[model samples]
Target: MILDVQGKAAYAYTGGKPFDASLPSTVFIHGAEHDHSVWALQTRYFAHHGFGVLAVDLPGHCRSAGPALRTVAAMADW
Candidate 1:
């Protein structure tokens, strides 16, 4: 799935299911230079167990658009 965050495109893998905001959500953030695919197994498990998984590709990483966040605070805010 893709979200508009701070006017930029943010990409998230939904673990093969449509996202449901009302369900429990888990946000997965990858390490430096990585993307959402890193959490493939875990996200799939969580989603199958009734969680709304959002394994995100940070800005400028993989499918996400815009400049990379320079600070931890900024990443958290996004």
Candidate 2:
């Protein structure tokens, strides 16, 4: 599932179908220099367990558009 959160393009992936016995949502945020792809393992594992996982590459990193900088705050905002 994809969500436009206040104009920010958010990417989400789900496991199982609606009304699934396991209906849980896990939002994952990665560390600096890392993008959503970092959660590939966790996403797959959680999804296999019937949990929905939402991971996104923060702005300015990886596939997401933005800028590259050298500041803690800058990376956080990304």
Clashes of each: 0, 1
The ten-residue window of minimal lDDT in model 1 covers 69-78
C-alpha positional error of residue 47 in candidate 2 after TM-score superposition, expressed in Å = 0.5
lDDT of every predicted structure (CA atoms): 0.91, 0.63
Q: Compared with the true structure, what per-residue lDDT tens digits does model 2 show for residues 1-78?
A: 555744766554443323233467787777778877878888778877767667766666665554544787865654
- Cα lDDT tens digits, model 1, 1-78, are 989988888999999899899999999999777899999999999999999999999998999999888887878787
The Cα error of candidate 2 at residue 73, in Å, is 6.2
RMSD of candidate 2 to the truth, in angstroms, is 3.9
| Candidate 2 off by > 4 Å | 13-22, 68-78
- Can you give the lDDT of residue 68 in candidate 2? 47
* Candidate 2 TM-score versus the reference: 0.63
How good is model 1 by TM-score?
A: 0.90
Question: Which runs in model 1 stand beyond 4 Å of their true positions?
Answer: none
Clashing pairs in 2: 59-78
